[model samples]
Target: MLHARIVRGAERATSYEVTLWALALVTLALDVVTTTYGLEVGLAEMNPFVNYLLPTLGLAGTFVVLKSFALLVGVAAWWTMPSKVRGVVPLGLALPWGIAAVSNTVLLAGIHL
Candidate 1:
C-alpha cells in the first residue's frame, strides 16, 4: 500500500507546480524592486499627490506584502511535497495570512500608527 501510494504521488507532480514556483519568483522580484529599490514605491505607499489615499495605500501595500509571502510558502510546499500532501497546500497558504490580516487590523485599531 505504501509503495502504491508513493507511485501515485510521483505521478501527480505537474507543470502547474512549476508555474506556481515561477509566480513565487516573480512576486519576490517585484517586492524587492518596489519595497527595497524605491521604484514607484513612494507612489504606491505614500502618494502625496492624492492626499486622501495614504491610508488606503498603506493598507494595500501591507496586503501585497502579506500575499507575496503566502504565495511563496504555497509554491514552496507545492513544489516540494508529494501529491497527497499538496492537497493541504492551499490551507497551509491561507490560514496564516488570514490570521496576519486580522492581527494587523487589530493592531491598527489600537495604535493608530
Candidate 2:
C-alpha cells in the first residue's frame, strides 16, 4: 500500500508538471503574438531588454532569442530543482508572460475599439 501510494504521488506530480509546462509555453506564444501585433500598430515595448534588441533583431528574431533563452533557463531550473519545489519553474515562467499577454490584448482592444 505504501509503495502504491508513492507511485500514485509520483504520477500526480508528473501530470502537474506537464500541465504547468504546457501553460508556460502557451502563454509564451500568446505573449509573442500579442507583442508583435502591438509593435506593428506602433505600440512600444515595455521591456527595456526587448526594446534594446528590437532595432537590431526586429520582431521575430528578438522573440526567438529571448524566449528561447527563457525556456532554456526554465528547463535548467526544472531539471536541477527538488521534486517538492518543481512547480515553481513553470509558474515563474508562465505568470509574467500570461500577464503581459493579457495586458497587450487589452491595449490592442482599446486601440481597435
Candidate 3:
C-alpha cells in the first residue's frame, strides 16, 4: 500500500502537514490565477529542474509532472519527515507565495505597483 492502512483511529495530518498542504494549495491556486492576469514570466526564470524536463515533455506534460512531484514530496514529508523540517518547508513557500498573492491582488484591483 502507498500509505499504511489505518486501523484504529483515523490518520490525521499534523500541524506541519496542514500548514504545508494549505501553503501548497494556496500557492498553486495563486499561480494559476496570476498567469491569467497579463503576468508573463520568461522561460529562463523557470526552475532549472523543470526547464530541463520541458524540452522532452511539452507544456501540459511538464506542468503535470511538476505538480505530481510536489504532491508526492508533500505527502512524503507529511508522513515521514520531522515536524521541524516540515514546518520550515511551508515557511519557505509562504513568503514568495504571499508576495505573489498580494501583488496579483493589487494588479487585479488596478493599482499597479
Q: Tell me, by lDDT, which candidate is best.
A: 2
Using TM-score as the yardstick, the better of models 2 and 3 is 2
Instruction: Give RMSD (Å) of candidate 2 vs. truth.
Output: 5.5
lDDT value, residue 16 of candidate 3: 53
Clashing pairs in 3: none
What C-alpha lDDT values do all the predictions have?
0.50, 0.87, 0.56
**Each candidate's clash count:** 0, 0, 0
For model 1, where is the 10-residue window of minimal lDDT?
A: 36-45
Q: Best TM-score goes to which candidate?
A: 2
lDDT of 3 by residue, 2-113 (tens): 3343311122333455666687678866754563353343212235775687679855677678667766775675558555345544544555657766666666566443
Sort by lDDT, best first: 2, 3, 1
The window of 10 residues in a row where model 2 has the poorest summed lDDT is 6-15
Candidate 2's TM-score reads 0.84
Model 2 pairs whose backbones collide:
none
Model 2's alpha-carbon lDDT is 0.87
What is candidate 1's TM-score against the reference? Answer: 0.35
Poorest lDDT segment (10 consecutive residues) of candidate 3:
5-14
On residues 53-85, what C-alpha lDDT tens digit does candidate 2 reach at each position? 989998899999999999999889889976766
- Candidate 1 — which residues are off by over 4 angstroms? 1-57, 96-113
